[model samples]
Target: MDLDNIKDIWSQENPDTTPEISLENQKELHLPLEKLRKNMRKEFWSTIVLFVFIILFLTFVDFHFFKFKIYVITLVASMMLITAFYYYKFFLLYKNLTSVDFNLLENLKDLKFQFKLNEQYYLGYYIAFVPFTVAEVILIFEFIPGWKNLTGFSFILYLSIFCLLMLGALYVVGKWWFQKFYGKYFSQILNLIDDLK
Candidate 1:
């Protein structure tokens, strides 16, 4: 940006000053923030694509890709897919979540607090799913012919219980996270948006 253009923007603070601000200077000021927003959107979509592909494969293709049986392949594929997606998505969400240029410091500080709280909740999600994931993978071994007698009903029971446990964990985590982070700041952001309107 040209010095005179920078001077123009800086001069806005002081009515007594007369300075020219370059268009380049204005563009430069906004460039980083725009880049950050675009990068965040890109990261989000990457994870979304990963998840959609996993769902597509599981829903359509049979999983016998190698020496692994279909059941084992499905179990491993699903678990790995979910784990990677969650890890990647949460990492990006925490890393990219940000705000700035608000009119009030209190509002900005609240938004900062929300970012921290959300990171914590993502960590919670990572922890809660571990047990469920283990159980989900075990169902594959039970599909072996003779193994059905030993693992059949028990396997189904484990799957059912694990699913319920996962949901309960998610609910608890969500509630706690909402109260800890999102509940307070969400309303504030909404109010700010409304006021701007």
Candidate 2:
């Protein structure tokens, strides 16, 4: 193949016919994949750690150390599940982020698709917390074996106070964090779409 001659002809093409997903842009994107993949690997391992810790902790609670202790464990279990769920959501997002490569037309589409998936992931995260937050309150006061002292009224009062405090703090932190991280990325994707147009 006459590579030099092919480039000479290709470079002279009418600009209007070519889409904004240009070859140069795609080439630049390839450099980031390794970094993205590294992040994905880190996320994967962190999730495994969360899983193991939760299981081990629940096992400890099964030994029935104290009546009130189980409530504490139930709280811990709820927190762990919530933590693990959010991380898993991030893993899904990062997995898509890592797979993007702008080296081809299909890859550009893939990048956009990946970002859309990330958006859904965030919405899903919010939806999941709803049930988790509710169940955590319910489990603390209703379920969880070995209940003693603490009147049902007192139980509700203390549990509501503690969970509301934790949930509020977590919500604030999550809002700030989501805006700091995912919000920026999603905007970047929108800009990319504009560039593509």
Candidate 3:
């Protein structure tokens, strides 16, 4: 065969495989995406159930102190509201899993944005609990007779220290919870994105 004919044969024989490789990468993404969606849905439903139980308890149980009841109910309601908002945000992310409309890089960037947004939401969610923590301390002092012994600067000192300690503990616990629920999938998605590069 002539040189041009040989070149034509070579070109046709070794057609570009880029599209095939892209399809495979898209397939690879589905597993992690499904896992992330499944996990989010599970957490969302569980949170709803928990808040329902809390609402029922708040409705039925009569704590002798009206202020205690008010504080506890308010705290639970606030938590439920925050959780609902986050879950709505999460659901939006989950819906994106079904469509592979974006290229791999774009998807990775979007996922990274979601992960960071969620981390912020998680921190804020925990921070929201601080007020309730302080209220609990206040209720104990006001209603629980034994705590009356702690008064003046001693009371101020103890409450301040306790609130700080509780807030710190909450931060740690929230971090752990996020890691437990999300760390594996987050790492997997990151690795996949890196592999694409």
Candidate 4:
């Protein structure tokens, strides 16, 4: 074939057409997206308040041992750092959702991916605290007067069991919390995508 003829055929075969969401579908998407954004805002602000309360409580509360206060404050500070990282990502998604033009199906798909990715991040945020929890527990045992009575293998065994149980509980609670806050809206978005498809 001549180059001119081949070019024409290629142009005809590959039109620059992207699937656009209909106005009706865009309207359908608005509710769930708004719900997700609202929930995110509420959670974010609540977390900030809770952290502030924790810091104040730690600073002002009377503890028998000074080391206990320091250790907890340090752990809370570390948690705040980790939380800041995750919230930065969360804020990006919040911004994306806010700015969604809903013009293309691909945009919705990308938003869905963001939701799923952030869901994983949410769980990781919880799991990340496991070490902090363990350390805090150890501090409690060391500094608290009552726990001093437990000695040797008994302390080790109890701490191990408690940590194991806490690990499982965190995972379960994380899943539940996600479902309660965002999963329902996520389901709605998935349904909207399916309808669009």
Candidate 5:
């Protein structure tokens, strides 16, 4: 066959797969996407408010040790910074969902990818606090006179156990939290994509 014939055959076989979304499908998608965006916004604002409350509480609460206060404030500040970073990425996804110009199939695929990526970020956000939790535990042991009785091998063993338990709990909780807040919407999107296929 001539090159022109081959080209025509190829074009026919692989017609544009990413078509514009129909008004009906877009309307169907509107609810789930809006729910996801709404939940994200609520979570973001709640986090900000919770952080503010924590800072204020720490500032006003009496602490016998100045070092403990400083350490906790610094830790909270660092956590806020990390949370802000993740939220920025989430905001980008939110913006994409809001855009009117996206191609249907391609955009759905991209959004699905973004959702999976963000789910990892969500888990990482929790896991990232492991070190901070350990530090806080150390601080508690140091500042609280009652906890000082643990020493040498006993202290190390207890700390190790506590950290392990905390790590597992954080992972489990992170998964549950993500599923509770966002998983349904993600599943809905996946179903929509399947329908398109």
Candidate 6:
């Protein structure tokens, strides 16, 4: 065979057309995505349930002081806003994640976007709770007769310490929650993308 003729024939084949994936192979490829979708949905519904419970508690439970009621209302309102915004975000993520017809590169790009978005969301979500946590401490001081004496620098110190501790705990818990739910699948998808590359 002439070398130039063989090279010309090989180069004529369509390079853009990907091989058709077998059903079993496609299912295997999508397994991580399916698991991620399930976990995200579970998180979304659980958040809804928790929000409903909080609303019920705030509406039904009696707080003798008007200030306490106002605090609870504020807390609920903030929580509602945060939850709504994040739910929308989660919905978009779910929609994108479950979408089909994407090739390997597109899938990898989407996954990387999701991983980064989630990291930002996790940070914002935890930071958003800081105000409520501080409010709880304020309410405790306001209501509890014995603790009312905490004031001036002492109160400031106590509040600062408590807030810092709560933030630290929230950070740790958020990391663990994400790691447990999405991190494993993220790693798998990353590996798949790498292997494809």
Largest TM-score belongs to which candidate? 4
Count clashing pairs, candidate 2.
1
For model 3, how does the per-residue alpha-carbon lDDT over 44-142 read when each residue is reduced to its tens digit?
888878888888888998898887788777877777777778777777777766664535476566776776677677677777778877777777777
Enumerate residue pairs that collide in model 2. 26-102
Poorly placed runs, candidate 6 (over 4 Å): 1-25, 102-104
* Candidate 1 lDDT score relative to the true structure: 0.55
Global lDDT scores for all candidate models: 0.55, 0.63, 0.75, 0.87, 0.83, 0.79
Q: Over the full model, what C-alpha lDDT does candidate 6 score relative to the true structure?
A: 0.79
Model 3 per-residue lDDT at 124: 78
Clashes of each: 2, 1, 0, 0, 0, 0
Considering lDDT, where higher is better, how would the candidates rank from best to worst? 4, 5, 6, 3, 2, 1
The TM-scores of all predictions, comma-separated, are 0.39, 0.57, 0.77, 0.90, 0.87, 0.82
Residue-by-residue lDDT tens digits, candidate 6, 1-197: 89999888888886776544345545666989889899999998898899889889888998888987997798889888987887788788888887755454655666677777876886788788888887887787778787788889988888788778877888789889988998898788667665555
Clashing residue pairs for model 4: none
lDDT of 1 by residue, 9-72 (tens): 9877886543433455434434443544454457567767876886676667764444344554
The predicted structure with the larger TM-score, 1 or 5, is: 5
Per-residue error (Å), model 5, residue 150: 1.1
Q: What's the true lDDT of residue 99 in model 1?
A: 39
Highest-scoring model, lDDT: 4
Q: Which prediction has more favorable TM-score, 3 or 4?
A: 4
Q: In candidate 5, which residue ranges exceed 4 Å CA deviation?
A: 1-17, 100-103
* Pick by TM-score: 1 or 2, better one: 2
lDDT of 5 by residue, 1-197 (tens): 99999999999988766588787887778888899989998998998899889989997899888988899889988988888898898888888878834356777778778888988888788878988888878887788898878999999998888777877887788788788789989899779876976
